[model samples]
Target chain A: MTDQASGSIHSFYVHTLGTPGTESLFWLCATLAVFGLGMRLQIRLGRAPWANPVLFSIILIAAALFVTETPYATYFQSVHIINFLLGPATVALAIPLADSIRLVTKSLPTMTLALLAGSVTSVVSGIALVLLFGGSHEVALSMAPKAVTTPIAIAITSQIGGSPALTAAFAILGGIIAAMIGETTLRRLGITDWRAHGLAAGIAGSGIAAAQVAQRDPVGAAFAALGIGLNGLVTAILVPVILHFLPG
Target chain B: MPEAFFTLLVFQLIGTAAQAALNLPVPGPVIGMFLLAALLIWRKSRASRREAHSPLSPDSEPGTSAASPALAALSRTLIACLGLLFVPAGVGIITELPVLSANALPIAVALFGSTILGLMVTALVMHRATTGGAAPEKLPDTGGQVL
Candidate 1:
């Protein structure tokens, strides 16, 4: 298609955003719909990680895309509307952060340092791990930004000559897996203090842990969110340098 | 879920629109939060100054309300978003099942190592800061310190 034609908008009655014969719309809607359905199904059955609402939505959407033979690129394009919402939603989190201004003000310096340390460690080591496992330089670079928020990770991944798409997925997966067994992990380590537990959760779980911490301990959540933000920054700056130290 | 979803949706819309209209660079939630914070800060400053100079006062300190309605509202919002927060993370987990499930053990070790490294660094820095600082005596205790 020509540039002019590509930029033109089209929605033939039941359009797929800009594309045609796309099951993107179906998968997208089903993602939200099946979430409700899954929760109900969960109540009827049980809350298995396999059938958790979020995982369920992913499954439903994945299946839709797979069965309908929809491409990930197409799915991302159609879902860009929701993705755009993510930006605002992230900004809105500042609301809680602001509300806990008193709490934030108290631990400002400590939180920054902690977040910086955690972020730098995660990203640097992630690169080291991939390289150690015999991953290509591109793959190692891609994995380097997996501990930060998606936007930041995507940005850093691109900067480091890695695949943004891969990093985004890895970032989310790392976050979810941390959250899934976060509490159990803490318990096994013999850390029972609420603050420690909550803080650890936020660092590991990213936004999800931050959300959980916001309810009980906004400070910890703030730490986690700050960690997410800083991790992206540090990873973006350090991953390339860190990679240089590794054997080529 | 419906009630929580609706509440978050409305607030998110309000937040997003406010962010867009204001031409803020950050996320809508961050903008909405800043707006909310500005209001609170204004109220706090005005109350503190008034309390400091007032000849007569309703309470010992105007800024100190034991059970303010605003805090309650914020609390409610935080609680409502708890479950919703997991949605994104869970979706992410499913997406990386092949990688995570395949190398669960190594990943677990990494998690522990990183957390320990973080905690030790945090404790040292916090302690050094405390010992070195000579300014305000009543610095805020960061309720949670997760290294």
Candidate 2:
């Protein structure tokens, strides 16, 4: 009886978790379910740095894939719909950015200079540390644009022969870490200006960090939004120029 | 709301097409934003000119003003869930664990060091710029606002 019960339970698990019907639909549902789980955790944790939705969701989804023996390719293929939204979602940023730009028009010059400096700092520092630490050339290249937003980071990474996968990882890592530690660092340093705090976090972390900043204050979000766009623009321009001048 | 959604889609489509045609390195959405900004600027200039022409109507709404329903609604919707859209790309990181694990020490150190350093320097620069070139003065507490 015990043997029979165990066999029945195992089969039931396979039947439910395994790709039983339309594979694409199954995968899509699974991805949504995982993301939803991540979102719940994020809310319950009050969106803490360690409880980041993206990080949590990825962990849950990855574990699910491991347990179900589902191939990464299969999961990716089924969730291309979600991936595709990244394009439109990026465009959506323009709206808030435009609003922010209007509000901060008078401070544009100072903000622009700060962002340019920050952008170059992000690239140079990232690549330098990667090389200093014995990372590969590919990792160095990927690390160069890791401080920017994902879509643009992916573009720059591909352009400069870095792994898009690695770039995404770095981008998310940078964002989460910055979101977690950025504000505290600024406060400790006695940096009270919202613009300074926003630019710093946004440049270091880009999209995810900006999102966290946005949750705190509108003014901070504006600077962060501006930082996200400007950082991407500057990094895109600087990486190639800097690489061209580098001694191989 | 539907109209606002349509406007967003149209702008996004235009942005994508521009990226493809120009072979731009920037993302399509960013280009779309540029186009949107240009359009809004033009609209605002036109609105102000018209207001100037009629000088009687001091209450004319400027183009891209907060009063604009579609822009306001759409932007709010997008901002509300801006964080959600990033989850997929973050999920992509799971597939690259091997490469990450291979360079675990270097990647971790580089990322952590560079991020902290970048944040510090950027904050300092911005602080100097915004505070009349004065260094930041230490404060007992910012009421957690800075965080």
Candidate 3:
């Protein structure tokens, strides 16, 4: 088929399948359907290290959007409902954190140091790598808090003149990467304690990866929750202060 | 589950309100989480104080008060599917493909290196604090198991 003919045919298909208001339903359904399929695929794959449901779903949905020539905004209109739940989901973290308070309080000092160090390392390492790789200043800034949770990472990205959207991508990317490699790496180093594992995942991975860690141990989840909250709080304060000292 | 969901939504509402009122940089849900944790802790303390005089039993944990069940259920449901909640935003990454692609090498290197380094450093420091800098004599096959 000729390029123009294929383009016209594609447009016709989309027009026939999706109308203005109805597109929201399609996109919402598409998002969930793809996500469900991804979940099933992960389960079928026996939850292999590389077969993460979130990453799988994102790839499937993004491909669907591209094929249909659908704008991201159209898809996001309905998907945002799922996005809105992130806040409540974050609040849910307090449940695990509270449940493990005794453990959290017992090693407050170590946890505090780990959180602070992890937060700073995430910001500095991201920015430094961006610069070293010849990325622009905004890219560096956007990536600065990539290790933190999405909402806070977005907030910090905007505060420091970076793109919030990019920050969200970076946050998700970091979370997936951390969730994928965090436990295995720790084990490679002979780190066995769930507390250390959870704290590391929480600080390095933020809430998403922390949730992954939460599946292992409630005590770990509690610390992961603490790591998320404390890392965000620390990064929020530290990013601006550190930027003030840096050249850019 | 529905009641538990609503209870969490209420806590989230208070958190969002707190964020707006205080102009805090931290996300509202995070603040709300702290608030919820505090309330649960206080409730447990009160329950514990009352339980102090009663005959001690193995089943009587401080935090397992009657008021806790609903929130516990809510938290479990939310956390279990936490990965699903993040999909919309993760899908948004496609919108930035141009930027991601252009800087793909650097972004990839940075994300990969920094995440690995961050995990190692944080884990090491935590291990130091937790175990007094003692290294385990033999490595265990962590298998990256959840628990």
Candidate with maximal lDDT = 3
Docking class of 1: incorrect
Write model 2 residue lDDT over A143-177, tens digit each, in one string: 99999988789889999999988998999988888
Which candidate has the top score in DockQ?
3
Q: What would the per-residue lDDT of candidate 3 be over residues A1-248, giving only the tens digit for each residue?
A: 56687678569747775777667787778777877787688679876545677888888888777777778877777678888888888888877777667667778888788887887888888999999989888899998988887788899889889999898898899999988778878887888777888888888889768867776666677778878888888988999998998885
CA lDDT of B70 in candidate 3?
72
TM-score, ranked from best to worst: 3, 2, 1
TM-score between candidate 3 and the true structure: 0.89
Tell me which of candidates 1 and 3 scores higher on lDDT. Answer: 3
Angstrom error at residue B79, model 1: 7.7
Which candidate number has the best TM-score? 3
**Tens-digit lDDT string for candidate 3 (B40-62):** 77776677678777787354554
- iRMS values for every prediction: 6.0, 3.5, 3.2
Q: Between candidates 2 and 3, name the one with more favorable DockQ.
A: 3
Task: Name every residue pair that clashes in candidate 1.
Answer: A88-B28, A91-B27, A91-B29, A91-B30, A92-B28, A92-B29, A92-B30, A95-B33, A106-B140
**Worst 10 contiguous positions by lDDT, candidate 3 chain A:** A45-54
lDDT of 3 at B72: 85
Would you give me the overall lDDT of model 3?
A: 0.80
- Where is model 1 more than 4 Å wrong at Cα? A1-29, A37-52, A77-79, A190-202, A212-220, B1-43, B51-147
